[model samples]
Target: MTVRYAANKDVQIAYEVLGDPATGVPLLLIMGLDYQMVWWPDEFCEQLVAAGFAVVRFDNRDTGLSTHFAKGDSYTGNDMVDDALAVLDAVGWSDANVFGGSLGAAIGQALALLHPERVRSLVSVMGTPVTAGTLRTLRYVRFGTVAKLARLPKAATREQEIDNLVTVYRTVASPGYPFPEDWARHVATLSHDRHPRDPGTTVRQNAASRRFTVPALSTLTRPTVVIAGADDPLVRPVAGRDTARQIPGATFVSYPGMGHNLPEELWPDIIERTRAVAR
Candidate 1:
């Protein structure tokens, strides 16, 4: 992946462009909270490329190789949304199809609402809208799953941290599919090597997410598709249904046996749906 940078004010957002821009439609990929772009598998990207898309994946601020923040410094959700716009400008694409996973899905919602002219379409998966706020957002979460995953012991070394993350991935992974342990480990290792695990970023990202509200989803005009893993242990399927219901003409899809983790088996279906949405 060739790394590039987009300046969102003083922040230099790190991004990478895959596939030939001249040959395929542009697809901006946003990963979940505190998760780097590396969490997006190269194989999945390659498949998207083969399907005729020039994929642009970026590390959100406070994650991966992107700029870090001080203990007290904070940014709003618009900052994160504009960070994406900066990336689009860097890639020279006026607009593109977008795919956001988990917290990314919420960001995508905000992106479409905040900059309607810059997004051709959006695909949101395993996430609740940040605009939903604290209490409303809590309704969609399964606390038992969160409690189990949160119980992992803290790690002092890189290897230990990788192990802890892999365990988290496995626990939330789809129950009916074979676990992609290798991909999970690779993502964890990259996440650790690029930046040591910091609990502060997670807290900050969560805070910014909670603070964002406006342009209620009903006012959104972009073509969108909300995907939910029917069996997700973290965010419930109803969240996806509700998100789609709020947007006029938006499509809602739910897959049984899918969880917080994106199963490779569903990639084809998602890619095709993206093609339809982007059109």
Candidate 2:
């Protein structure tokens, strides 16, 4: 059965513990920005669990059922790292292999750098260390700039929200695959049920990201595998290449024509390949 553990602040951290806790290695999976733990995909998690790794996947603060901090409250990576550590402690796991996608990958990198002793191994998928003048950074800034210029913040109507969601769906949905409108609506309901997003929390998280850099990449000793989709528009192949190169003994794998989204067709291969890295 899935279990819930309380953070020190009394906020219940919900997690689904999979596989045998004592077999293979403990694997912790972290999701991306504003993404619920559900985004990790049940089949993918099950594949990992079946591969003999004790798997733990949880909701990060303000995303899933985790506690939502104040909108205006400022927080740093230290605070986030603390929350992750606390979750580990509450669950009675000292340390585990870390797998993070996108922002979660960034957090995994930070955890490896900040508390290397706590990480058994690391898999950073579609993540990168901060660097100036990189195409990735420039593209993110350009998108944010355009959003601000277009007055996207003034979107208050539910119609506007739907339009926003549809636009994003069009951009990211796998080609020829049907958009899961029902699933989107279901998730929207869960999002509202959990907690209304505080604009301040997002702002604070952005601030923390801005102030963070992966200088510690050179110091990470954990066995690391950096995975990237060659066609990813948000984070290009070069970014992943650079990240893998910076870390000693890190391996980089590129999937041709694969975009940011994890297509169901690739789940079995992705899961098996990722799990192999743990061995």
Candidate 3:
């Protein structure tokens, strides 16, 4: 429950560590676009800790308690990758196992490619490879969903903000998994109260993802696992498969009826798969 800051060049990245570092492999969890580290469920982190991992969850630059940027001064995706390395250095770990989703997943892939020595293992969940070409042609099968996300209404009031977030979760959530409306509302409320909503930061992050192209990944030697939701409307399952196909000896897993959101029911499987790869 203790929060700390790690210095990365000019920025101070905020992070929280769970479980004893002396106990197990260091596991770093990276969250997605515009989402803070708090988006990672406390229970999910606890389960990984109980499974013998020292978990480190952090706010990626413009999100959470980390450093905020001016309108046009945001860092690019490669800069964020170095930020991850700085987090490891701050914690006195030479290397660690990494798990990321969405944007986080893209960062994890870049980390494995650029700094292979710093990553012990990698797990990418509901993420796609971020190449310049992919960004140029980024279109989901559900074009209507993309349109709705693109035109999400701005909320001037707290209640309206929560409602907006609820709508978002509903729009992207897996049809087969129960949507936890109440929990989503709670998280939205906390996020709204904790930090100022910055649309520009999200825009810059998206641009960064598009600007930074991943190097050829067919030669990646790190143990990697790619997880995709069969019904994911955001990134799509094909992107996940494509990522795994690029990495040699990497494992790919798809959950039926799952979407962009990770449900509590699939956590056990995620933990087991992550542990297997870490071994």
lDDT of 3 by residue, 52-97 (tens): 9999999998987999888868568898998899899888889999
TM-score of 3: 0.95
Worst 10 residues of 2 by lDDT: 140-149
Give each prediction's root-mean-square deviation over alpha carbons: 1.1, 3.5, 1.6
In what order do the candidates fall by lDDT, top score first? 1, 3, 2
User: Candidate 2's residue-wise lDDT over 106-145, tens digit each?
Assistant: 7888888888888888888876664323444555332542
TM-score of 2: 0.82
Clashing pairs in 3: none
Off by over 4 Å in 2: 1-3, 6-12, 130-170, 173-189, 213-215
TM-score pick, better of 1 and 2 = 1
lDDT digits (tens) for residues 36-56 of candidate 1: 898888988999998999999
Instruction: Give the Cα error of residue 202 in candidate 3, in Å.
Output: 1.5
What C-alpha root-mean-square deviation, in Å, does candidate 1 show against the real structure? Answer: 1.1
Give the whole-model CA lDDT for all candidates, comma-separated. Answer: 0.89, 0.68, 0.85
